[model samples]
Target: MPAKLTILTNGSIKVEGDFEVCDPQGGVFNVAGKPAVFLCRCGQSAKKPFCDGAHKTCGFTSEVKASA
Candidate 1:
């Protein structure tokens, strides 16, 4: 399946399907064979690129909408 990203309300961005996360330097994240991943959007995650559920306690809020 193609990569899909779902931004959660007041939380992390849900990532699914065939995908691999890479940093700006071309380093790849070890997400192989995983069903999904929650990426940090709040910028409060100690896990950096991954979500550790910090948004729940950090008072993060965002409502993103797609442009038509």
Candidate 2:
């Protein structure tokens, strides 16, 4: 299945299905067979590009909605 990226309101980006995550240096980060993944957007997660639930404490906010 193709991957889908969903931008959450006031939260991280939710990625579902098959996907590939890579670093700026062209190194791929292993997903370990996860069907879905949550990416950090608040820039507060100790795990960059992956949500660590830091938005709650960091006061990240967004009102944007996902469209079909």
Candidate 3:
């Protein structure tokens, strides 16, 4: 299975592949081979770590490159 990488405009890193998401509370959210994962970068997400589309309002953009 190939990993899917996506670069969003005015948003954080949206990774869609075999990965895991962990919070500061020691909470782990396993993707189990998901198709999309939004990572926070604006440092103002109410969801923390995970992006909740707050970047649209904050105008936060990521300069990440997509790779297969």
Candidate 4:
């Protein structure tokens, strides 16, 4: 699938396969850098880049796909 990037409804960005998530403090976040990760968009997640289901409680929804 060449590493899929899916933006779910009222949820974080679903990232699969291979990628890198670097913190603002110059730190790389990776739990072995193998498992799939969900990045937060609503900014209400307790797990920072990872989603903690806080988007649902904040009524967040994103489904806009820009065409290239």
Candidate 5:
């Protein structure tokens, strides 16, 4: 399946299908064969680049909208 990314309202980015996640240094973060992944957007997750459900407590907000 083709990779798809969905930005959740005021939350993390939901990614599905075949995809690769990499760090700033070009190191790949293994997903362990998982079919879906949620990425941090509020910059509050202790697990940077991954969602730790911190947005709920961090008061993160965004007015930007994404188009399909």
Candidate 6:
């Protein structure tokens, strides 16, 4: 399936389908064999690029909508 990215309000970016997460040096994140993953947006996640539900207590606030 094609990858789909959903930006959650005041939270992480929910990712589904086939995709890959990599760093600048081309080191890839281990999302292998997983159906879905949540990427951090609040920067409060102890898991770095991945969300650890830290936004719930970090006082983060954001609500974005796509525009075309």
Local distance difference test, candidate 4: 0.82
Segments in model 5 whose C-alpha atoms lie over 4 Å from true places: none
Residue-level lDDT for 5 in candidate 6 = 98
TM-score of each: 0.91, 0.89, 0.62, 0.76, 0.86, 0.92
After superposition of all CA atoms, the RMSD between model 3 and the true structure is 3.8
lDDT of 2 by residue, 1-68 (tens): 89899999999999988789989999999996898899999999999989999999898999986569
Worst 10 residues of 3 by lDDT: 1-10
Q: What is the lDDT of residue 29 in candidate 2?
A: 90
Error of 5 at 5 (Å): 0.3
Per-residue error for 39 in candidate 6, Å, reads 0.6
| Model 3 error, position 10 (Å) | 1.8
lDDT of model 2 at position 11: 94
Q: Can you write out model 6's per-residue Cα lDDT over 1-68, one digit (the tens) per residue?
A: 99999999999999999899999999999999989999999998989899999999999999899999
Q: Residue 63 error for model 1, in Å? A: 2.4
- Note the residue pairs that clash in candidate 6: none
Supply candidate 4's per-residue lDDT for 44: 94
**Clashes by residue pair, model 5:** none
Cα displacement (angstroms), candidate 2, residue 29, comes to 0.5
The model with the greatest TM-score is: 6
Over 4 Å off, model 3? 2-5, 24-27, 30-33, 61-68
lDDT string for model 1 (19-66, tens) is: 899999999999888999999999999999999999999999998877
Position 3, candidate 1: lDDT: 91
Looking at candidate 5, what is the lDDT of residue 45? 98
The regions of model 2 sitting more than 4 angstroms off are: 66-68
Worst 10 residues of 1 by lDDT: 59-68
* Comparison by lDDT, 1 against 4, better one: 1
